[model samples]
Target: MQGHTPTPVFSVRDKRNLLFIILGLVPAAALAFWLHILPVFQGLYLSLFRWSGLSPKRKFVGLANFRALANDSLVWKALGHDVYMVVFRLTAVIVLALLFAGILHFSSRRKQKIVQGLFFFPNVLSVAVVGIIFTFIYNPSIGALNAILTNLGLENLTQAWLGNPKTAFPAVLFPTVWGAVGYQMLLLFAGMSSIPKAYTEVALLEGATRIQEFFQVTLPLLRNVVKTCVSLVVINTLNRTFIFIRVMTKGGPNDATEVLGNYMFYQGFENFKFGYATSIAVINFTLALVLTFVVTRLLKKENLEYA
Candidate 1:
Protein backbone atom coordinates (compact mmCIF):
# COMPACT_ATOMS: atom_id res chain seq x y z
CA MET A 1 0.00 0.00 0.00
CA GLN A 2 2.81 2.40 0.82
CA GLY A 3 4.36 1.81 -2.60
CA HIS A 4 1.07 1.97 -4.42
CA THR A 5 1.17 5.68 -5.29
CA PRO A 6 1.09 5.63 -9.08
CA THR A 7 3.57 7.70 -11.05
CA PRO A 8 1.96 10.81 -12.45
CA VAL A 9 0.82 10.20 -16.01
CA PHE A 10 0.30 12.50 -18.95
CA SER A 11 -3.43 13.17 -18.98
CA VAL A 12 -5.50 13.66 -22.15
CA ARG A 13 -5.28 17.46 -21.68
CA ASP A 14 -1.51 17.36 -21.20
CA LYS A 15 -1.07 15.26 -24.33
CA ARG A 16 -3.29 17.67 -26.29
CA ASN A 17 -1.17 20.64 -25.08
CA LEU A 18 2.00 18.87 -26.13
CA LEU A 19 0.50 18.19 -29.54
CA PHE A 20 -0.30 21.89 -30.04
CA ILE A 21 3.22 22.89 -29.04
CA ILE A 22 4.71 20.49 -31.58
CA LEU A 23 2.30 21.74 -34.24
CA GLY A 24 3.33 25.37 -33.67
CA LEU A 25 7.03 24.58 -33.87
CA VAL A 26 6.80 22.79 -37.23
CA PRO A 27 6.44 25.88 -39.45
CA ALA A 28 8.97 27.90 -37.45
CA ALA A 29 11.57 25.16 -37.71
CA ALA A 30 10.87 24.70 -41.41
CA LEU A 31 11.21 28.44 -42.04
CA ALA A 32 14.51 28.63 -40.14
CA PHE A 33 15.94 25.76 -42.18
CA TRP A 34 14.72 27.16 -45.49
CA LEU A 35 15.91 30.70 -44.90
CA HIS A 36 19.11 30.34 -42.90
CA ILE A 37 20.44 26.77 -42.73
CA LEU A 38 19.86 25.95 -46.39
CA PRO A 39 21.85 28.92 -47.67
CA VAL A 40 24.88 27.97 -45.55
CA PHE A 41 24.80 24.42 -46.93
CA GLN A 42 24.47 25.71 -50.47
CA GLY A 43 27.44 28.04 -50.05
CA LEU A 44 29.58 25.27 -48.56
CA TYR A 45 28.71 23.00 -51.45
CA LEU A 46 29.51 25.66 -54.03
CA SER A 47 32.87 26.37 -52.39
CA LEU A 48 34.33 23.00 -53.40
CA PHE A 49 34.36 23.71 -57.12
CA ARG A 50 36.13 25.74 -59.83
CA TRP A 51 33.22 27.46 -61.51
CA SER A 52 33.34 30.83 -63.19
CA GLY A 53 30.06 32.74 -63.47
CA LEU A 54 29.25 31.18 -66.87
CA SER A 55 30.48 27.63 -66.40
CA PRO A 56 27.85 24.92 -66.26
CA LYS A 57 30.57 22.30 -66.06
CA ARG A 58 30.96 22.85 -62.28
CA LYS A 59 34.48 21.40 -62.07
CA PHE A 60 34.90 19.97 -58.62
CA VAL A 61 38.29 20.99 -57.21
CA GLY A 62 37.72 19.57 -53.72
CA LEU A 63 39.04 22.03 -51.12
CA ALA A 64 41.56 23.54 -53.55
CA ASN A 65 39.90 26.91 -53.16
CA PHE A 66 40.23 26.79 -49.40
CA ARG A 67 43.86 25.72 -49.76
CA ALA A 68 44.49 28.68 -52.03
CA LEU A 69 42.75 30.96 -49.60
CA ALA A 70 45.14 29.73 -46.89
CA ASN A 71 48.09 30.76 -49.05
CA ASP A 72 46.53 34.03 -50.19
CA SER A 73 48.52 36.86 -48.60
CA LEU A 74 45.92 39.47 -49.50
CA VAL A 75 43.24 37.43 -47.74
CA TRP A 76 45.36 37.29 -44.63
CA LYS A 77 45.95 41.01 -44.73
CA ALA A 78 42.24 41.68 -45.16
CA LEU A 79 41.52 39.40 -42.21
CA GLY A 80 44.07 41.24 -40.11
CA HIS A 81 42.31 44.53 -40.85
CA ASP A 82 38.98 42.97 -39.89
CA VAL A 83 40.45 41.75 -36.60
CA TYR A 84 41.74 45.25 -35.89
CA MET A 85 38.31 46.67 -36.66
CA VAL A 86 36.63 44.22 -34.28
CA VAL A 87 38.74 45.50 -31.39
CA PHE A 88 38.56 49.20 -32.24
CA ARG A 89 34.88 49.30 -33.17
CA LEU A 90 33.80 47.39 -30.09
CA THR A 91 35.84 49.58 -27.80
CA ALA A 92 34.61 52.86 -29.27
CA VAL A 93 30.97 51.85 -29.47
CA ILE A 94 30.72 50.22 -26.04
CA VAL A 95 32.60 52.85 -24.05
CA LEU A 96 31.08 55.88 -25.73
CA ALA A 97 27.57 54.45 -25.73
CA LEU A 98 27.82 53.40 -22.12
CA LEU A 99 28.94 56.87 -21.08
CA PHE A 100 26.20 58.60 -23.12
CA ALA A 101 23.55 56.10 -21.99
CA GLY A 102 24.43 56.87 -18.38
CA ILE A 103 24.05 60.57 -19.06
CA LEU A 104 20.70 60.17 -20.80
CA HIS A 105 19.32 57.61 -18.37
CA PHE A 106 19.91 59.99 -15.48
CA SER A 107 18.69 63.09 -17.32
CA SER A 108 15.16 64.51 -17.22
CA ARG A 109 12.60 62.82 -19.46
CA ARG A 110 12.26 65.67 -22.00
CA LYS A 111 16.02 66.18 -22.31
CA GLN A 112 16.61 62.41 -22.59
CA LYS A 113 14.00 62.02 -25.33
CA ILE A 114 15.39 64.89 -27.43
CA VAL A 115 19.03 63.83 -27.09
CA GLN A 116 18.29 60.12 -27.60
CA GLY A 117 16.49 60.85 -30.86
CA LEU A 118 19.39 63.00 -32.04
CA PHE A 119 21.85 60.25 -31.16
CA PHE A 120 19.87 57.57 -32.97
CA PHE A 121 19.08 59.70 -36.05
CA PRO A 122 22.04 58.38 -38.02
CA ASN A 123 20.77 54.80 -37.75
CA VAL A 124 17.53 55.64 -39.55
CA LEU A 125 19.29 56.75 -42.75
CA SER A 126 20.55 54.31 -45.37
CA VAL A 127 24.18 53.34 -44.84
CA ALA A 128 25.00 54.35 -48.39
CA VAL A 129 23.78 57.87 -47.70
CA VAL A 130 25.81 58.08 -44.51
CA GLY A 131 28.87 56.90 -46.43
CA ILE A 132 28.31 59.44 -49.16
CA ILE A 133 27.94 62.25 -46.67
CA PHE A 134 31.05 61.20 -44.80
CA THR A 135 32.94 60.87 -48.07
CA PHE A 136 32.31 64.58 -48.55
CA ILE A 137 33.03 65.25 -44.91
CA TYR A 138 36.42 63.59 -45.27
CA ASN A 139 37.19 65.30 -48.58
CA PRO A 140 40.46 67.13 -48.01
CA SER A 141 39.69 70.24 -50.03
CA ILE A 142 36.28 71.48 -48.93
CA GLY A 143 35.22 68.93 -46.34
CA ALA A 144 33.72 70.12 -43.06
CA LEU A 145 36.20 68.14 -40.97
CA ASN A 146 39.29 69.74 -42.49
CA ALA A 147 37.60 73.12 -42.49
CA ILE A 148 36.98 72.87 -38.75
CA LEU A 149 40.50 71.63 -38.13
CA THR A 150 41.97 74.43 -40.24
CA ASN A 151 39.95 77.05 -38.42
CA LEU A 152 41.03 75.63 -35.06
CA GLY A 153 44.68 76.21 -36.06
CA LEU A 154 45.19 72.43 -36.41
CA GLU A 155 45.73 72.64 -40.17
CA ASN A 156 48.69 70.32 -39.76
CA LEU A 157 46.29 67.61 -38.68
CA THR A 158 44.23 67.87 -41.84
CA GLN A 159 45.19 65.37 -44.54
CA ALA A 160 43.63 63.09 -47.14
CA TRP A 161 41.97 60.93 -44.48
CA LEU A 162 40.51 58.40 -46.93
CA GLY A 163 43.42 58.50 -49.40
CA ASN A 164 46.28 58.03 -46.96
CA PRO A 165 47.02 54.40 -46.19
CA LYS A 166 47.85 55.26 -42.61
CA THR A 167 44.50 57.03 -42.08
CA ALA A 168 42.16 55.11 -44.46
CA PHE A 169 41.35 52.22 -42.15
CA PRO A 170 40.43 54.44 -39.23
CA ALA A 171 38.54 56.77 -41.53
CA VAL A 172 36.33 53.91 -42.72
CA LEU A 173 35.87 52.64 -39.16
CA PHE A 174 34.98 56.03 -37.68
CA PRO A 175 31.67 56.19 -39.53
CA THR A 176 30.77 52.69 -38.41
CA VAL A 177 31.48 53.49 -34.79
CA TRP A 178 29.66 56.81 -35.02
CA GLY A 179 26.49 55.30 -36.46
CA ALA A 180 26.57 52.38 -34.01
CA VAL A 181 26.82 54.48 -30.83
CA GLY A 182 23.19 55.57 -30.77
CA TYR A 183 21.77 52.10 -31.13
CA GLN A 184 24.09 50.66 -28.52
CA MET A 185 23.44 53.58 -26.21
CA LEU A 186 19.70 53.09 -26.48
CA LEU A 187 20.04 49.37 -25.75
CA LEU A 188 22.17 49.94 -22.66
CA PHE A 189 19.91 52.78 -21.54
CA ALA A 190 16.90 50.49 -21.68
CA GLY A 191 18.69 47.96 -19.52
CA MET A 192 19.64 50.70 -17.07
CA SER A 193 16.10 51.98 -16.96
CA SER A 194 14.88 48.48 -16.01
CA ILE A 195 17.02 48.32 -12.87
CA PRO A 196 14.81 48.37 -9.78
CA LYS A 197 14.71 51.89 -8.33
CA ALA A 198 14.81 50.38 -4.86
CA TYR A 199 18.35 49.10 -5.47
CA THR A 200 19.68 52.58 -6.22
CA GLU A 201 17.80 54.04 -3.23
CA VAL A 202 19.31 51.43 -0.92
CA ALA A 203 22.81 52.14 -2.29
CA LEU A 204 22.31 55.84 -1.70
CA LEU A 205 21.10 55.18 1.84
CA GLU A 206 24.33 53.28 2.47
CA GLY A 207 26.26 56.53 1.63
CA ALA A 208 27.65 55.13 -1.61
CA THR A 209 28.93 57.67 -4.10
CA ARG A 210 27.36 57.79 -7.58
CA ILE A 211 30.43 56.15 -9.10
CA GLN A 212 30.43 53.43 -6.43
CA GLU A 213 26.72 52.75 -6.98
CA PHE A 214 27.23 52.51 -10.73
CA PHE A 215 30.19 50.14 -10.55
CA GLN A 216 28.72 47.91 -7.84
CA VAL A 217 24.97 47.93 -8.55
CA THR A 218 23.95 49.25 -11.96
CA LEU A 219 26.63 47.60 -14.09
CA PRO A 220 26.39 44.21 -12.39
CA LEU A 221 22.66 44.09 -13.07
CA LEU A 222 23.25 45.02 -16.72
CA ARG A 223 25.80 42.31 -17.43
CA ASN A 224 23.47 40.34 -19.70
CA VAL A 225 22.53 43.47 -21.61
CA VAL A 226 26.14 44.46 -22.18
CA LYS A 227 26.93 40.98 -23.48
CA THR A 228 24.02 41.15 -25.89
CA CYS A 229 25.15 44.59 -27.13
CA VAL A 230 28.67 43.30 -27.71
CA SER A 231 27.37 40.33 -29.68
CA LEU A 232 25.17 42.52 -31.86
CA VAL A 233 28.02 44.93 -32.54
CA VAL A 234 30.23 42.04 -33.66
CA ILE A 235 27.58 40.73 -36.04
CA ASN A 236 26.72 44.16 -37.45
CA THR A 237 30.35 45.11 -38.03
CA LEU A 238 31.12 41.86 -39.84
CA ASN A 239 28.13 42.13 -42.16
CA ARG A 240 28.33 45.87 -42.85
CA THR A 241 32.08 46.12 -43.38
CA PHE A 242 31.64 45.13 -47.01
CA ILE A 243 29.17 47.88 -47.84
CA PHE A 244 31.15 50.55 -46.02
CA ILE A 245 34.43 49.60 -47.64
CA ARG A 246 32.88 49.26 -51.07
CA VAL A 247 31.07 52.59 -51.09
CA MET A 248 33.66 54.70 -49.33
CA THR A 249 37.13 53.31 -49.93
CA LYS A 250 36.47 50.39 -52.31
CA GLY A 251 39.27 48.66 -50.39
CA GLY A 252 41.65 51.27 -51.66
CA PRO A 253 44.31 53.43 -50.05
CA ASN A 254 46.47 50.54 -51.28
CA ASP A 255 44.00 47.98 -49.85
CA ALA A 256 44.56 49.12 -46.31
CA THR A 257 40.82 48.84 -45.64
CA GLU A 258 40.12 45.47 -47.24
CA VAL A 259 37.74 43.33 -45.20
CA LEU A 260 35.93 40.04 -45.71
CA GLY A 261 32.70 41.40 -47.15
CA ASN A 262 34.00 43.67 -49.91
CA TYR A 263 36.83 41.30 -50.70
CA MET A 264 34.37 38.46 -51.16
CA PHE A 265 32.35 40.64 -53.52
CA TYR A 266 35.42 41.54 -55.52
CA GLN A 267 36.44 37.91 -55.92
CA GLY A 268 33.00 36.63 -56.87
CA PHE A 269 31.60 39.40 -59.01
CA GLU A 270 34.45 41.56 -60.21
CA ASN A 271 36.98 38.80 -60.73
CA PHE A 272 34.36 36.19 -61.68
CA LYS A 273 35.85 33.63 -59.31
CA PHE A 274 32.61 32.31 -57.87
CA GLY A 275 34.07 29.19 -56.32
CA TYR A 276 36.88 31.09 -54.67
CA ALA A 277 34.44 33.67 -53.43
CA THR A 278 32.21 31.03 -51.90
CA SER A 279 35.25 29.64 -50.13
CA ILE A 280 35.77 33.03 -48.63
CA ALA A 281 32.14 33.03 -47.58
CA VAL A 282 32.65 29.74 -45.83
CA ILE A 283 35.58 31.21 -43.96
CA ASN A 284 33.63 34.31 -43.07
CA PHE A 285 30.67 32.33 -41.80
CA THR A 286 32.92 30.00 -39.81
CA LEU A 287 34.80 32.88 -38.23
CA ALA A 288 31.58 34.59 -37.22
CA LEU A 289 30.14 31.39 -35.79
CA VAL A 290 33.25 30.66 -33.75
CA LEU A 291 33.43 34.17 -32.35
CA THR A 292 29.77 34.23 -31.38
CA PHE A 293 30.09 30.88 -29.60
CA VAL A 294 33.20 31.96 -27.70
CA VAL A 295 31.60 35.25 -26.67
CA THR A 296 28.48 33.48 -25.43
CA ARG A 297 30.52 31.10 -23.29
CA LEU A 298 32.68 33.90 -21.95
CA LEU A 299 29.70 36.09 -21.06
CA LYS A 300 27.70 33.26 -19.56
CA LYS A 301 25.46 34.60 -16.82
CA GLU A 302 25.38 33.26 -13.27
CA ASN A 303 22.46 32.80 -10.89
CA LEU A 304 22.58 36.27 -9.42
CA GLU A 305 19.71 36.89 -7.03
CA TYR A 306 17.71 39.94 -8.12
CA ALA A 307 14.34 40.88 -6.71
Candidate 2:
Protein backbone atom coordinates (compact mmCIF):
# COMPACT_ATOMS: atom_id res chain seq x y z
CA MET A 1 0.00 0.00 0.00
CA GLN A 2 1.20 3.54 -0.77
CA GLY A 3 1.16 6.22 1.96
CA HIS A 4 -1.30 9.08 1.33
CA THR A 5 -1.55 12.61 2.75
CA PRO A 6 -4.73 13.50 4.72
CA THR A 7 -7.13 15.94 3.17
CA PRO A 8 -7.98 19.18 4.96
CA VAL A 9 -11.17 19.07 7.03
CA PHE A 10 -12.30 22.40 5.66
CA SER A 11 -11.63 24.23 2.42
CA VAL A 12 -9.60 27.46 2.56
CA ARG A 13 -12.73 29.60 2.13
CA ASP A 14 -14.56 27.57 4.81
CA LYS A 15 -11.64 28.03 7.21
CA ARG A 16 -11.63 31.78 6.53
CA ASN A 17 -15.37 31.99 7.09
CA LEU A 18 -15.05 30.03 10.34
CA LEU A 19 -12.33 32.38 11.54
CA PHE A 20 -14.41 35.44 10.71
CA ILE A 21 -17.42 33.97 12.47
CA ILE A 22 -15.37 33.18 15.57
CA LEU A 23 -13.89 36.67 15.56
CA GLY A 24 -17.38 38.12 15.29
CA LEU A 25 -18.47 36.03 18.28
CA VAL A 26 -15.44 36.86 20.43
CA PRO A 27 -17.06 39.72 22.38
CA ALA A 28 -20.25 37.77 23.08
CA ALA A 29 -18.32 34.64 24.03
CA ALA A 30 -16.10 36.64 26.37
CA LEU A 31 -19.07 38.34 27.98
CA ALA A 32 -20.99 35.09 28.39
CA PHE A 33 -17.96 33.42 29.96
CA TRP A 34 -17.43 36.27 32.37
CA LEU A 35 -21.05 36.74 33.36
CA HIS A 36 -22.64 33.30 32.96
CA ILE A 37 -20.16 30.47 32.45
CA LEU A 38 -17.54 31.56 34.98
CA PRO A 39 -20.14 32.07 37.68
CA VAL A 40 -21.60 28.59 37.16
CA PHE A 41 -18.16 26.97 37.59
CA GLN A 42 -17.46 29.15 40.60
CA GLY A 43 -20.77 28.10 42.10
CA LEU A 44 -20.02 24.43 41.53
CA TYR A 45 -16.69 24.79 43.29
CA LEU A 46 -18.24 26.66 46.19
CA SER A 47 -21.00 24.07 46.59
CA LEU A 48 -18.41 21.50 47.70
CA PHE A 49 -17.29 23.59 50.70
CA ARG A 50 -18.63 25.19 53.85
CA TRP A 51 -18.23 28.94 54.21
CA SER A 52 -20.16 32.02 55.02
CA GLY A 53 -20.12 34.43 52.10
CA LEU A 54 -17.79 36.92 53.84
CA SER A 55 -15.73 34.81 56.23
CA PRO A 56 -12.08 33.91 55.89
CA LYS A 57 -12.61 30.42 57.31
CA ARG A 58 -13.23 27.90 54.54
CA LYS A 59 -13.71 24.16 55.04
CA PHE A 60 -13.99 21.57 52.29
CA VAL A 61 -16.80 19.14 53.12
CA GLY A 62 -17.24 17.53 49.75
CA LEU A 63 -20.83 16.56 48.84
CA ALA A 64 -22.04 17.43 52.34
CA ASN A 65 -24.10 20.34 51.11
CA PHE A 66 -25.79 18.23 48.47
CA ARG A 67 -26.60 15.61 51.10
CA ALA A 68 -28.14 18.31 53.27
CA LEU A 69 -30.17 19.47 50.28
CA ALA A 70 -31.49 15.96 49.83
CA ASN A 71 -32.86 15.88 53.39
CA ASP A 72 -34.20 19.42 53.48
CA SER A 73 -38.01 19.43 53.42
CA LEU A 74 -38.02 23.10 52.48
CA VAL A 75 -36.06 22.26 49.36
CA TRP A 76 -38.79 19.93 48.14
CA LYS A 77 -41.52 22.36 49.08
CA ALA A 78 -39.84 25.21 47.27
CA LEU A 79 -39.23 22.95 44.30
CA GLY A 80 -42.92 22.04 44.18
CA HIS A 81 -43.84 25.69 44.14
CA ASP A 82 -41.31 26.27 41.36
CA VAL A 83 -42.83 23.48 39.28
CA TYR A 84 -46.31 24.87 39.79
CA MET A 85 -45.16 28.35 38.90
CA VAL A 86 -43.38 27.18 35.78
CA VAL A 87 -46.32 25.14 34.52
CA PHE A 88 -49.03 27.70 35.20
CA ARG A 89 -47.05 30.76 34.19
CA LEU A 90 -45.75 29.15 31.03
CA THR A 91 -49.21 28.00 29.96
CA ALA A 92 -51.06 31.21 30.79
CA VAL A 93 -48.53 33.59 29.32
CA ILE A 94 -47.98 31.67 26.08
CA VAL A 95 -51.69 31.07 25.49
CA LEU A 96 -52.70 34.66 26.15
CA ALA A 97 -49.81 36.02 24.13
CA LEU A 98 -50.65 33.86 21.18
CA LEU A 99 -54.34 34.77 21.35
CA PHE A 100 -53.62 38.50 21.48
CA ALA A 101 -50.95 38.20 18.82
CA GLY A 102 -53.38 36.49 16.45
CA ILE A 103 -55.96 39.20 17.02
CA LEU A 104 -53.37 41.90 16.50
CA HIS A 105 -52.11 40.32 13.30
CA PHE A 106 -55.57 40.44 11.77
CA SER A 107 -56.59 43.88 13.04
CA SER A 108 -56.27 47.20 11.25
CA ARG A 109 -52.93 48.96 11.61
CA ARG A 110 -54.40 51.67 13.88
CA LYS A 111 -56.05 49.09 16.12
CA GLN A 112 -52.92 46.95 16.13
CA LYS A 113 -50.73 49.82 17.35
CA ILE A 114 -53.18 50.79 20.08
CA VAL A 115 -53.71 47.23 21.33
CA GLN A 116 -49.97 46.51 21.30
CA GLY A 117 -49.20 49.61 23.33
CA LEU A 118 -51.86 48.77 25.91
CA PHE A 119 -50.70 45.18 26.16
CA PHE A 120 -47.02 46.04 26.42
CA PHE A 121 -47.29 48.96 28.83
CA PRO A 122 -46.80 46.77 31.90
CA ASN A 123 -43.33 45.74 30.67
CA VAL A 124 -42.21 49.36 30.91
CA LEU A 125 -42.78 49.35 34.67
CA SER A 126 -40.15 47.96 37.03
CA VAL A 127 -40.81 44.59 38.65
CA ALA A 128 -40.68 46.14 42.10
CA VAL A 129 -43.33 48.64 41.10
CA VAL A 130 -45.56 45.94 39.70
CA GLY A 131 -45.11 43.79 42.79
CA ILE A 132 -45.95 46.66 45.07
CA ILE A 133 -48.98 47.50 42.98
CA PHE A 134 -50.22 43.91 43.24
CA THR A 135 -49.51 43.86 46.97
CA PHE A 136 -51.80 46.83 47.47
CA ILE A 137 -54.39 45.28 45.26
CA TYR A 138 -54.29 42.10 47.30
CA ASN A 139 -54.30 43.75 50.70
CA PRO A 140 -56.86 42.32 53.08
CA SER A 141 -58.41 45.66 53.79
CA ILE A 142 -59.11 48.37 51.26
CA GLY A 143 -57.55 46.43 48.35
CA ALA A 144 -58.93 47.21 44.93
CA LEU A 145 -59.90 43.58 44.35
CA ASN A 146 -61.80 43.35 47.59
CA ALA A 147 -63.41 46.71 47.06
CA ILE A 148 -64.61 45.66 43.65
CA LEU A 149 -66.03 42.44 45.01
CA THR A 150 -67.81 44.20 47.86
CA ASN A 151 -69.37 46.74 45.52
CA LEU A 152 -70.61 43.95 43.32
CA GLY A 153 -72.36 42.29 46.30
CA LEU A 154 -69.85 39.49 46.39
CA GLU A 155 -68.21 40.30 49.72
CA ASN A 156 -68.02 36.59 50.56
CA LEU A 157 -65.85 35.98 47.56
CA THR A 158 -63.17 38.39 48.76
CA GLN A 159 -60.18 37.26 50.79
CA ALA A 160 -56.60 38.31 51.35
CA TRP A 161 -55.01 37.37 48.02
CA LEU A 162 -51.33 37.46 48.93
CA GLY A 163 -51.77 36.84 52.65
CA ASN A 164 -53.54 33.51 52.74
CA PRO A 165 -51.27 30.51 52.36
CA LYS A 166 -53.57 28.85 49.86
CA THR A 167 -53.61 31.83 47.48
CA ALA A 168 -50.16 33.37 47.85
CA PHE A 169 -48.30 31.29 45.28
CA PRO A 170 -50.98 31.68 42.62
CA ALA A 171 -51.36 35.37 43.46
CA VAL A 172 -47.67 36.03 42.85
CA LEU A 173 -47.99 34.41 39.42
CA PHE A 174 -50.69 36.74 38.13
CA PRO A 175 -48.49 39.82 38.06
CA THR A 176 -45.72 37.85 36.42
CA VAL A 177 -48.06 36.70 33.66
CA TRP A 178 -49.58 40.16 33.31
CA GLY A 179 -46.22 41.81 32.83
CA ALA A 180 -44.89 39.09 30.54
CA VAL A 181 -47.85 38.69 28.18
CA GLY A 182 -47.21 41.87 26.21
CA TYR A 183 -43.57 41.18 25.37
CA GLN A 184 -44.37 37.61 24.35
CA MET A 185 -47.34 38.75 22.31
CA LEU A 186 -45.17 41.18 20.43
CA LEU A 187 -42.64 38.46 19.75
CA LEU A 188 -45.31 36.10 18.37
CA PHE A 189 -46.89 38.92 16.40
CA ALA A 190 -43.59 39.61 14.73
CA GLY A 191 -43.29 35.93 13.93
CA MET A 192 -46.76 35.98 12.45
CA SER A 193 -46.00 39.09 10.40
CA SER A 194 -42.80 37.62 8.99
CA ILE A 195 -44.88 34.72 7.61
CA PRO A 196 -45.79 35.33 3.99
CA LYS A 197 -49.43 36.21 3.28
CA ALA A 198 -49.42 33.72 0.42
CA TYR A 199 -49.32 30.83 2.86
CA THR A 200 -52.55 31.89 4.55
CA GLU A 201 -54.14 32.68 1.21
CA VAL A 202 -53.23 29.24 -0.11
CA ALA A 203 -54.61 27.57 3.00
CA LEU A 204 -57.88 29.47 2.68
CA LEU A 205 -58.08 28.73 -1.03
CA GLU A 206 -57.67 25.05 -0.25
CA GLY A 207 -60.82 25.23 1.95
CA ALA A 208 -58.94 25.26 5.22
CA THR A 209 -60.75 27.00 8.03
CA ARG A 210 -59.05 29.85 9.90
CA ILE A 211 -58.59 27.62 12.94
CA GLN A 212 -57.13 24.86 10.80
CA GLU A 213 -54.87 27.33 9.02
CA PHE A 214 -53.58 28.62 12.34
CA PHE A 215 -52.93 25.17 13.78
CA GLN A 216 -51.42 23.68 10.59
CA VAL A 217 -49.76 26.69 8.99
CA THR A 218 -49.12 29.60 11.38
CA LEU A 219 -48.04 27.62 14.43
CA PRO A 220 -45.81 25.23 12.54
CA LEU A 221 -43.92 28.14 10.97
CA LEU A 222 -43.62 29.92 14.32
CA ARG A 223 -41.86 26.99 15.97
CA ASN A 224 -38.47 28.72 16.32
CA VAL A 225 -39.96 31.85 17.83
CA VAL A 226 -42.16 29.85 20.17
CA LYS A 227 -39.15 27.83 21.23
CA THR A 228 -37.22 30.97 22.03
CA CYS A 229 -40.14 32.30 24.06
CA VAL A 230 -40.43 28.99 25.94
CA SER A 231 -36.72 28.94 26.73
CA LEU A 232 -36.89 32.53 27.98
CA VAL A 233 -39.85 31.71 30.21
CA VAL A 234 -38.12 28.68 31.72
CA ILE A 235 -34.92 30.63 32.46
CA ASN A 236 -36.91 33.50 33.93
CA THR A 237 -39.04 31.18 36.03
CA LEU A 238 -35.90 29.75 37.60
CA ASN A 239 -33.78 32.90 37.99
CA ARG A 240 -36.08 35.90 38.00
CA THR A 241 -38.70 34.60 40.45
CA PHE A 242 -36.49 35.92 43.25
CA ILE A 243 -37.57 39.53 42.85
CA PHE A 244 -41.25 38.62 42.68
CA ILE A 245 -41.04 36.39 45.72
CA ARG A 246 -39.01 38.96 47.63
CA VAL A 247 -41.22 41.92 46.87
CA MET A 248 -44.66 40.32 46.71
CA THR A 249 -44.75 37.67 49.45
CA LYS A 250 -41.19 37.15 50.77
CA GLY A 251 -41.95 33.43 50.76
CA GLY A 252 -44.33 34.11 53.58
CA PRO A 253 -47.28 32.33 55.29
CA ASN A 254 -44.89 29.64 56.52
CA ASP A 255 -42.92 29.49 53.26
CA ALA A 256 -46.07 28.76 51.34
CA THR A 257 -44.91 30.74 48.34
CA GLU A 258 -41.31 29.61 48.50
CA VAL A 259 -39.38 28.91 45.29
CA LEU A 260 -35.81 27.74 44.87
CA GLY A 261 -34.45 31.21 44.21
CA ASN A 262 -36.17 32.65 47.28
CA TYR A 263 -35.00 29.82 49.50
CA MET A 264 -31.46 30.02 48.09
CA PHE A 265 -31.31 33.74 48.87
CA TYR A 266 -32.66 33.11 52.33
CA GLN A 267 -30.02 30.47 52.96
CA GLY A 268 -27.05 32.43 51.64
CA PHE A 269 -27.75 36.01 52.66
CA GLU A 270 -30.22 35.75 55.53
CA ASN A 271 -28.74 32.66 57.24
CA PHE A 272 -25.20 32.91 55.82
CA LYS A 273 -25.07 29.35 54.50
CA PHE A 274 -23.18 30.16 51.34
CA GLY A 275 -22.24 26.56 50.55
CA TYR A 276 -25.76 25.24 50.94
CA ALA A 277 -27.13 28.20 49.03
CA THR A 278 -24.74 27.53 46.20
CA SER A 279 -25.94 23.96 46.21
CA ILE A 280 -29.45 25.20 45.66
CA ALA A 281 -28.11 27.45 42.94
CA VAL A 282 -26.45 24.46 41.30
CA ILE A 283 -29.77 22.63 41.33
CA ASN A 284 -31.51 25.65 39.84
CA PHE A 285 -28.96 26.01 37.07
CA THR A 286 -29.17 22.32 36.25
CA LEU A 287 -32.93 22.40 36.10
CA ALA A 288 -32.83 25.44 33.87
CA LEU A 289 -30.39 23.73 31.51
CA VAL A 290 -32.45 20.57 31.39
CA LEU A 291 -35.71 22.42 30.80
CA THR A 292 -34.19 24.51 28.05
CA PHE A 293 -32.85 21.39 26.41
CA VAL A 294 -36.26 19.74 26.61
CA VAL A 295 -37.96 22.76 25.07
CA THR A 296 -35.40 22.96 22.29
CA ARG A 297 -35.71 19.27 21.55
CA LEU A 298 -39.48 19.29 21.65
CA LEU A 299 -39.66 22.23 19.28
CA LYS A 300 -36.95 20.95 16.98
CA LYS A 301 -38.13 20.76 13.36
CA GLU A 302 -37.02 21.55 9.88
CA ASN A 303 -36.92 25.25 9.14
CA LEU A 304 -39.70 26.50 6.88
CA GLU A 305 -38.74 29.14 4.36
CA TYR A 306 -41.03 31.15 2.10
CA ALA A 307 -40.23 31.14 -1.58
Question: Looking at candidate 1, what is the lDDT of residue 42?
Answer: 85
The regions of model 1 sitting more than 4 angstroms off are: 1-37, 301-307
> Cα miss at 176, model 1 (Å)?
0.7
lDDT of 1 by residue, 1-307 (tens): 4656534453335677678768988989999999989987888999999999686788999999999999999899888887788778888999999999888867999999998999999888888988998899999988999999999999999998999999999999898887889999999999999889999889989999888888889988888898899899888877776698899999998989998888899999999999999998888777777776776677776844576
RMSD of each: 5.1, 5.6
Give candidate 2 misplaced runs (Cα > 4 Å): 1-37, 301-307
Query: Taking the tens digit of each residue's C-alpha lDDT, what string does model 2 give over 1-307?
Result: 2385334554335677678778889989999999989987899999999999788998999999999999999999988888788888889999999999988877899999999999999988999999999999999887999999999999998999988899888889999999999999999999999999999989999999988999899998898899989889989988996688899888998899998899989999999999999999998888889877986897797887664
Clashing pairs in 2: none
